[model samples]
Target: MSNKIKLTVLGLLITLNSLKAQQTSNKSYDVCIYGATSAGVVAAYTAAKYGKSVLLIEPGKHVGGMSSGGLGLTDIGNKYAISGIALDFYRRVGQHYGQFEQWIFEPHVAEDIFHTYLEKAKVPVLYQHRITAVKKQGNVITEILLESTGPRSVGRVKAKMFIDCSYEGDVMARAGVSYVVGREANTAYGETFNGVQLTNGHQLPDGIDPYKVKGDAKSGLLWGITKGQLAEKGSGDNKVQAYNFRICLSNDPKNRIPITKPAHYQPERYELLIRQMEKRTWKSLQDVFIWSRMPNQKTDINNRNGFSTDMIGMNWDYPDADYRKRQEIWSAHTDYTKGLLYFVGHDPRIPEHIRAEMNEWGYPKDEYMDNENWTHQLYVREARRMKGALVMTQHHCEGREMVQDGIGMAAYTMDSHNCERLVVNGMVKNEGNVEEGGFGPYPIAYRAITPKETEAANLLVPVCLSATHIAYGSIRMEPVFMVLGQSAALAAVKAIDGKSAVQEVDVAALQRQLKENPLADGSAPDVLIDNSDSFRVKVSGKWSVQKRGGYGPDYFLSDGHTDSSSFIRYYPDPNIKGRYEIYTYYAKLPERKAVTAVKVFDGKRLQEVVIKDEEVKVVGQTSGEWVKLGDYIFSGNGKPYVEITGNGEKVAADAVLLVAASK
Candidate 1:
């Protein structure tokens, strides 16, 4: 059947389901998780595992959000910081592939893992149940009404607690939660990278024109080009970050389905891309096409460089738009992306080599079988972020501020995708792509997910929790979402047990529980060092102590300008003796020095060894973990020590671990 006809039939089935569900009475549960995303599924599994009745409500036919969608190439920064249910999910994915754990896999494989987790937890999922209305009584949510789109009709779910795990924060917004869309000013939260960043990074090729007619001011701006005076940097605005589909493409003939022009292909929409190609402004198509390898030779394709997969400036209305409007936006994105693919593969204007390369890849026929080989979920990178009891800001991610009641940790860079395509100095430039990093793993406060007491007391927002734009960029990773989902579930359970508001849950108790509960395999590390232990420091310039969660609460950072004369040294116990491998843990950030020199003093010799600190590379997948420096022999009576000297870049000096290597 044609795509339109299939959608019509699906709509009719949903109407019939809604009508059927309206005839039944309201069902009660201990927890109602709206939007069966990866976060929602994990929340349901967690609540159900704790013996609470969970209703997993999904607005669409499928679940598992982006993970089950085409975003199979995980964007994990510090994999070691990921534990509990988040780690379990990856381990399950690994199990399916006959490995200990698989970080990259097929979309269907991820969906299978979600299904297994939910099924094992015995949680029932209600598909096509979009939350229509949320009933609130004073401070608590009384119930939620869902309109069915398939076989069930209108259904009411009464739960003591509700978790908004949707990417859009639909349920939370309906429940009168305060949320802010788009970018906030840096001054609003003392953040340097928050708002209106036109010149920040991710600029298009230097000479691309903004007008449809080159050099003609009267000519209207090209499609997708915003014509306006660029906003001052660090100022707040309503423009949201870009969104796209994490497309799954394949080169294997057995699975590849060649990109075809959409039914409503609009060549004019791609005028800018064609212009760039014709002008020979870009080096290669690969500059825009970032295809990361997934399992089975498939690829999780993403937008990169200038004018890529991200439909810039088209998703501002998505967070608040009604269901029908969202469908329209989704269709527009699909057409734009598919058209780009088709143009790259067929347009003669594209270089022949690039065209040939594009033609080799297409949608994987075996994936997204139910959705015409397209991913069901859109990459809603940023949307309506809730302004909860505690708003997480760049300060938190940078370790300038720390949350004592941290439920989990996020260790990724404070990254933001391009937010606007603007006319700058008579040329087209993409704005708001700030990729700042330096701070290590930071804690996610429980209060950040909890709504204010005056708002709904029972609601917890995990995916769309309280955070600034730059901070959200780091927190929006799938693994971090899963971690927050599990933490939200535990907090809900605690609130229910204590008969207290979600905002009033005892934080100390929550922290204690979280720390005490190790992984199911009992592999969590024990706290061995006290915070009071101080390393002797001699600084020629300046240094400061910064505390974050995954970095064992305290670490030292050099000033942005590093000098060779500045260094920090630490002396080990005088009695230590044996061949030991030295490992240094620092926040892996893009802005870190490519190499940091560590002066090691072994009993036999003193030598300087260079350590590569770039965290972006997948070297042993040890971004946040202990990175080995070198093995050295220490005498039992000598004062063995190590010194870190600056190399003119940002340097993080967290605690070092000395493991005994086999002699």
Candidate 2:
């Protein structure tokens, strides 16, 4: 056996031993979490920091879910939406790459960072443990029975508070919490793009036929095509969005494996792809799959236009299915994805250039060694969303309605994968794809995570929070989930101390805790002043506010001139007298200034310095960055600010950061 295999066995043995030890003791915990995903890990770490014993259980062996799986090309709508532990996770990843902040990284690197959190917090994790049943007193979950495959791993865990962090919300469903499976009608929540959308995204061209033989009514429909008539545009249904693997592949010859035919491979399952490909003048695989680049020559390839990796209409049974049935669906997705990849590269009907280009990529040898170098986590985009206290609707995302008691913010687009592939007007087409963005970050209400007062009192659902189907699409992202998880942990601690239900916890106190103690350890937070802060910012002349490639919510672009008439200044308030290191954000724009100069004010003196652009640049995938100018001492009563000196060519003013010297 190889050394990697030995290490894999040794790790499993260690986890089994830990589970056995904890089960024999039959000890209760202060907080118990189901699903050790990215959100669950953060929740457990936060609870441990608050001096609570946390038991994190997972149905699988590994952690970090899709964050470590393959969705490394982060879906960050704006950097302004991330903060606290969620921001810290990305910063830690940035540190690994020797930069200020990194939005993308490797799989093993992400998983290792998650392990670091567990080790530092001393949180016990039980692998392969699924909730069999729940024992409750009144509305509170007293204990839960586990069905583990490992020896002596099946036991009950008693806890004061329980958090359901799984993507499917299994624990929340098993506890009899109210939830919904699929999309709701547009009229149900005043949403424009919620149910049964037949938009022009990831759709097939108009002439492709659905039958096995062209122009034959007797021939049956091709494989993977849904058998249903088109529904009304705004009608509701129980159908679910597609789910697939975010396959990680590499181009490095020394660290790659061939894309061989997988087990139970069926070539006919991808018949629609072949028919779709023959019609279009496809150049290469890039037109078929998005070739998003990651660090170390790896790619976070995902579904693209027309026919791709998404197994549409095959995941409808996943949200509410049992363990055995879910596993079957999971295996089917795995086989279908692998089959799609292999068939594209080997089938003769495909274009020669496409097959040649697809052959250059394979599984990364150094990642996911425990699962044959394939990601074990499937991208379940939207599942069973909880019907909690206050459901967030599209009005909230559109800024028409706002919530003051927000625990976190979400900034991604209202994105949904195609739900089904059908023949519309006798032509093969895909439906239920939605992608809408161009709004600012909206606050996620605190009540969204808590269940109804009558359903269950002590449970918090972070991953599957309460929201309308279309609204949930915008709020469901990994970073947003992590932020919600940390907030859930804080609320759990507050509920335990107050001896009250989750819904009854003080919202004002919880928000104070989040802002004052972001890391949950009383560490002082760095002062930040963005261009969006109109209260602390003074702008002059015709500076246009542009987003797309700017820092925070938006950045100010000079009116195509280097003059004082179009300049911006940021006033930083540290709230306490101290020596601080200040930095300015440099946005990536079309115009580049050769020598961009910035003026820093320190109570009594104003100093100008050219930005050290070479000293601070994002290593791999990010566009915007932070450049440190210098440190200054500030008086408690003085107003210190940074002004972008419009001396060079065109310039962009984004945001400023003030870090204490003590940090």
Strongest candidate by lDDT = 2
Candidate 1 C-alpha lDDT tens digits along 259-323:
88878988888787876665545565567777777878788888887678899999889999999
**Worst ten in a row by lDDT for model 2:** 614-623
Number of clashing residue pairs, candidate 2:
0
TM-score of 1: 0.79
TM-score of each: 0.79, 0.95
Q: Which candidate ranks first by TM-score, i.e. highest?
A: 2
Alpha-carbon shift of residue 3 in model 2 (angstroms): 6.2
- What C-alpha lDDT values do all the predictions have? 0.78, 0.85
For residues 1-663, what per-residue lDDT tens digits would candidate 2 score against the true structure?
563985576487556636653764378888999998899999999999999988888888788989999988887777778888988899889889886578888888888898888878888888877888988888989998888865546578889999999999988988999999999999898888899999889988888989988889589898878889999997899999899888899989988899998999989888888777777778877888887888899988889987898998999999999888999999999999998889988989888888888899898888888788899799999889999989998888878899988999987788888998898999998989999887888899988999998889999999999998888888988889999999999999999999999999999999988988888877778788988799989987667788666666688877666566556889876355778888888876666676677888887789997875454455434447778878888886667789986553577888998877765
Candidate 1 residues lying further than 4 Å off, grouped into runs, are 1-25, 278-284, 518-663
Residue 344 displacement in candidate 2 (angstroms): 1.9
**Superposed model 2: Cα runs more than 4 Å off:** 1-6, 9-17, 20-25, 547-549, 574-581, 590-595, 603-623, 630-638, 661-663
